[model samples]
Target: GGIITQTPKFLIGQEGQKLTLKCQQNFNHDTMYWYRQDSGKGLRLIYYSITENDLQKGDLSEGYDASREKKSSFSLTVTSAQKNEMAVFLCASSMAKQDTQYFGPGTRLLVL
Candidate 1:
Protein backbone atom coordinates (compact mmCIF):
# COMPACT_ATOMS: atom_id res chain seq x y z
CA GLY A 1 0.00 0.00 0.00
CA GLY A 2 1.09 3.55 -0.67
CA ILE A 3 -0.24 4.55 2.74
CA ILE A 4 2.39 6.24 4.81
CA THR A 5 2.21 9.01 7.40
CA GLN A 6 5.49 10.76 7.80
CA THR A 7 6.99 14.04 8.96
CA PRO A 8 10.24 15.14 10.52
CA LYS A 9 10.34 13.74 14.05
CA PHE A 10 11.02 17.23 15.25
CA LEU A 11 10.64 20.56 13.49
CA ILE A 12 12.53 23.55 14.73
CA GLY A 13 10.47 26.68 14.24
CA GLN A 14 12.25 29.95 14.03
CA GLU A 15 10.51 32.75 15.86
CA GLY A 16 7.75 34.48 13.90
CA GLN A 17 8.37 32.25 10.89
CA LYS A 18 5.96 30.02 9.07
CA LEU A 19 6.31 26.26 9.68
CA THR A 20 4.84 23.59 7.52
CA LEU A 21 4.11 19.95 8.37
CA LYS A 22 3.19 17.34 5.83
CA CYS A 23 1.10 14.17 6.00
CA GLN A 24 0.09 11.50 3.54
CA GLN A 25 -2.41 8.66 3.80
CA ASN A 26 -3.46 6.10 1.24
CA PHE A 27 -6.31 4.49 3.10
CA ASN A 28 -8.78 5.76 0.51
CA HIS A 29 -10.55 7.61 3.27
CA ASP A 30 -12.65 10.64 2.45
CA THR A 31 -11.82 12.72 5.47
CA MET A 32 -8.47 13.98 6.71
CA TYR A 33 -7.87 16.03 9.84
CA TRP A 34 -5.26 17.86 11.88
CA TYR A 35 -5.10 18.23 15.63
CA ARG A 36 -2.90 19.95 18.17
CA GLN A 37 -2.02 18.60 21.59
CA ASP A 38 -0.20 20.49 24.29
CA SER A 39 2.13 18.93 26.88
CA GLY A 40 -0.45 17.30 29.16
CA LYS A 41 -3.73 18.29 27.59
CA GLY A 42 -6.28 16.88 25.22
CA LEU A 43 -6.18 17.05 21.47
CA ARG A 44 -7.88 20.01 19.85
CA LEU A 45 -9.06 19.96 16.29
CA ILE A 46 -7.16 22.37 14.07
CA TYR A 47 -8.50 21.69 10.63
CA TYR A 48 -10.21 19.08 8.50
CA SER A 49 -11.07 18.30 4.91
CA ILE A 50 -14.00 16.30 3.72
CA THR A 51 -12.77 15.92 0.19
CA GLU A 52 -10.05 17.03 -2.15
CA ASN A 53 -9.72 20.82 -2.25
CA ASP A 54 -12.26 21.27 0.50
CA LEU A 55 -11.07 22.80 3.73
CA GLN A 56 -12.93 23.36 6.98
CA LYS A 57 -11.70 25.29 9.95
CA GLY A 58 -11.92 23.73 13.37
CA ASP A 59 -12.12 25.27 16.84
CA LEU A 60 -8.42 25.91 17.10
CA SER A 61 -7.82 26.77 13.49
CA GLU A 62 -6.68 30.31 14.10
CA GLY A 63 -3.04 30.99 13.19
CA TYR A 64 -2.85 27.87 11.07
CA ASP A 65 -3.02 26.99 7.42
CA ALA A 66 -4.03 23.69 5.90
CA SER A 67 -4.44 22.23 2.45
CA ARG A 68 -5.94 19.11 0.96
CA GLU A 69 -5.33 19.11 -2.75
CA LYS A 70 -5.07 15.39 -3.38
CA LYS A 71 -6.97 12.46 -2.00
CA SER A 72 -3.94 11.02 -0.26
CA SER A 73 -2.25 14.17 1.01
CA PHE A 74 -2.66 17.11 3.31
CA SER A 75 -0.41 19.80 4.72
CA LEU A 76 -0.59 22.02 7.78
CA THR A 77 1.27 25.26 8.32
CA VAL A 78 1.52 27.43 11.37
CA THR A 79 1.10 31.02 10.23
CA SER A 80 3.44 32.36 12.82
CA ALA A 81 5.56 30.25 15.06
CA GLN A 82 5.65 31.56 18.57
CA LYS A 83 7.46 30.64 21.75
CA ASN A 84 4.23 29.55 23.37
CA GLU A 85 3.19 27.45 20.42
CA MET A 86 5.32 24.41 21.02
CA ALA A 87 3.10 21.36 20.70
CA VAL A 88 2.48 18.08 18.89
CA PHE A 89 0.76 17.92 15.54
CA LEU A 90 -1.24 14.85 14.73
CA CYS A 91 -2.77 13.75 11.45
CA ALA A 92 -5.57 11.29 10.87
CA SER A 93 -7.88 9.95 8.19
CA SER A 94 -11.29 8.32 8.16
CA MET A 95 -14.34 7.57 6.04
CA ALA A 96 -16.44 10.51 7.16
CA LYS A 97 -18.56 9.27 10.05
CA GLN A 98 -18.57 5.71 8.78
CA ASP A 99 -15.31 4.39 10.14
CA THR A 100 -12.84 4.98 12.87
CA GLN A 101 -9.97 7.28 12.08
CA TYR A 102 -6.42 6.07 11.81
CA PHE A 103 -3.92 8.43 13.37
CA GLY A 104 -0.35 8.90 12.29
CA PRO A 105 2.53 9.28 14.65
CA GLY A 106 2.69 12.83 15.96
CA THR A 107 5.29 15.38 14.84
CA ARG A 108 6.67 17.61 17.50
CA LEU A 109 7.14 21.31 16.91
CA LEU A 110 9.78 23.02 18.95
CA VAL A 111 9.56 26.76 18.56
CA LEU A 112 12.78 28.45 19.44
Candidate 2:
Protein backbone atom coordinates (compact mmCIF):
# COMPACT_ATOMS: atom_id res chain seq x y z
CA GLY A 1 0.00 0.00 0.00
CA GLY A 2 1.13 3.54 -0.77
CA ILE A 3 -0.01 7.15 -0.42
CA ILE A 4 -0.17 10.35 -2.41
CA THR A 5 0.71 13.76 -1.01
CA GLN A 6 0.22 17.25 -2.42
CA THR A 7 2.33 20.13 -1.25
CA PRO A 8 1.03 23.47 0.12
CA LYS A 9 -2.49 22.31 0.86
CA PHE A 10 -3.62 25.92 0.52
CA LEU A 11 -2.23 28.16 -2.16
CA ILE A 12 -2.71 31.93 -2.32
CA GLY A 13 -1.72 33.58 -5.56
CA GLN A 14 -2.00 37.02 -7.06
CA GLU A 15 -3.90 37.66 -10.20
CA GLY A 16 -1.84 37.02 -13.33
CA GLN A 17 0.78 35.21 -11.35
CA LYS A 18 2.12 31.82 -12.25
CA LEU A 19 1.89 29.14 -9.60
CA THR A 20 3.12 25.60 -9.48
CA LEU A 21 1.64 22.65 -7.62
CA LYS A 22 3.33 19.38 -6.80
CA CYS A 23 2.03 15.87 -6.41
CA GLN A 24 3.88 12.73 -5.32
CA GLN A 25 2.57 9.22 -5.26
CA ASN A 26 4.10 6.03 -3.98
CA PHE A 27 1.67 3.75 -5.71
CA ASN A 28 3.88 3.48 -8.75
CA HIS A 29 0.87 3.59 -10.97
CA ASP A 30 1.11 3.79 -14.72
CA THR A 31 -0.92 6.96 -15.12
CA MET A 32 -1.20 10.23 -13.26
CA TYR A 33 -3.58 13.13 -13.77
CA TRP A 34 -4.34 16.68 -12.72
CA TYR A 35 -7.90 17.91 -12.43
CA ARG A 36 -9.55 21.18 -11.49
CA GLN A 37 -12.83 21.57 -9.66
CA ASP A 38 -14.39 24.99 -9.81
CA SER A 39 -16.77 26.46 -7.28
CA GLY A 40 -19.87 25.16 -8.97
CA LYS A 41 -18.49 22.83 -11.56
CA GLY A 42 -17.39 19.26 -11.80
CA LEU A 43 -13.88 17.99 -12.23
CA ARG A 44 -12.13 18.96 -15.43
CA LEU A 45 -8.91 17.40 -16.61
CA ILE A 46 -5.94 19.68 -16.94
CA TYR A 47 -3.21 17.23 -17.81
CA TYR A 48 -2.11 13.61 -17.57
CA SER A 49 0.97 11.51 -17.93
CA ILE A 50 1.02 7.92 -18.97
CA THR A 51 4.59 7.27 -17.92
CA GLU A 52 7.74 8.95 -16.82
CA ASN A 53 8.66 12.01 -18.86
CA ASP A 54 5.34 11.87 -20.67
CA LEU A 55 2.86 14.72 -20.72
CA GLN A 56 -0.58 14.96 -22.24
CA LYS A 57 -2.70 18.08 -22.38
CA GLY A 58 -6.34 17.92 -21.45
CA ASP A 59 -9.38 20.06 -22.14
CA LEU A 60 -8.31 22.51 -19.44
CA SER A 61 -4.61 22.37 -20.13
CA GLU A 62 -4.52 25.83 -21.71
CA GLY A 63 -3.55 27.44 -18.40
CA TYR A 64 -1.50 24.63 -16.99
CA ASP A 65 1.52 22.45 -17.52
CA ALA A 66 2.29 19.04 -16.08
CA SER A 67 5.25 16.76 -15.66
CA ARG A 68 5.78 13.15 -14.73
CA GLU A 69 9.32 13.02 -13.47
CA LYS A 70 9.25 9.40 -12.35
CA LYS A 71 6.87 6.54 -11.90
CA SER A 72 5.93 7.90 -8.49
CA SER A 73 5.56 11.63 -8.99
CA PHE A 74 3.62 14.07 -11.15
CA SER A 75 3.57 17.86 -10.96
CA LEU A 76 1.58 20.73 -12.38
CA THR A 77 2.25 24.42 -12.90
CA VAL A 78 -0.32 27.09 -13.49
CA THR A 79 0.64 29.26 -16.46
CA SER A 80 -1.34 32.23 -15.19
CA ALA A 81 -3.47 32.67 -12.18
CA GLN A 82 -6.90 34.09 -12.95
CA LYS A 83 -9.36 36.04 -10.81
CA ASN A 84 -11.62 33.11 -10.34
CA GLU A 85 -12.98 32.11 -6.96
CA MET A 86 -11.46 29.40 -4.82
CA ALA A 87 -11.14 25.96 -6.31
CA VAL A 88 -9.64 22.59 -5.55
CA PHE A 89 -7.10 20.74 -7.65
CA LEU A 90 -7.16 16.99 -7.45
CA CYS A 91 -4.48 14.51 -8.40
CA ALA A 92 -5.33 11.00 -9.43
CA SER A 93 -3.65 7.80 -10.56
CA SER A 94 -4.73 4.71 -12.39
CA MET A 95 -3.30 1.54 -13.78
CA ALA A 96 -4.77 2.46 -17.14
CA LYS A 97 -7.34 4.70 -18.71
CA GLN A 98 -10.02 2.09 -18.22
CA ASP A 99 -9.12 1.29 -14.63
CA THR A 100 -10.41 2.83 -11.43
CA GLN A 101 -8.61 5.92 -10.20
CA TYR A 102 -7.60 7.01 -6.72
CA PHE A 103 -7.59 10.72 -5.91
CA GLY A 104 -5.63 12.86 -3.55
CA PRO A 105 -7.35 15.18 -1.08
CA GLY A 106 -6.78 18.30 -3.23
CA THR A 107 -4.94 21.57 -3.22
CA ARG A 108 -7.14 24.54 -2.51
CA LEU A 109 -6.14 27.73 -4.29
CA LEU A 110 -7.50 31.23 -3.95
CA VAL A 111 -6.67 34.15 -6.18
CA LEU A 112 -6.63 37.40 -4.30
lDDT against the true structure, per candidate, is 0.89, 0.90
Tens digits of lDDT, candidate 2, 1-112? 7788998799999999989899988887899999999867899999999989999989989978887889888999988898864899999998888898899889999998
RMSD of each: 1.5, 1.1
Give, for candidate 1, the lowest lDDT window spanning 10 residues. Answer: 1-10
lDDT of 1 by residue, 4-41 (tens): 58597689978899988999998888899999989788
- Badly placed stretches (over 4 Å) of model 2 are none
Q: Which residue pairs of candidate 2 clash?
A: none
Candidate 1: the clashing residue pairs are none
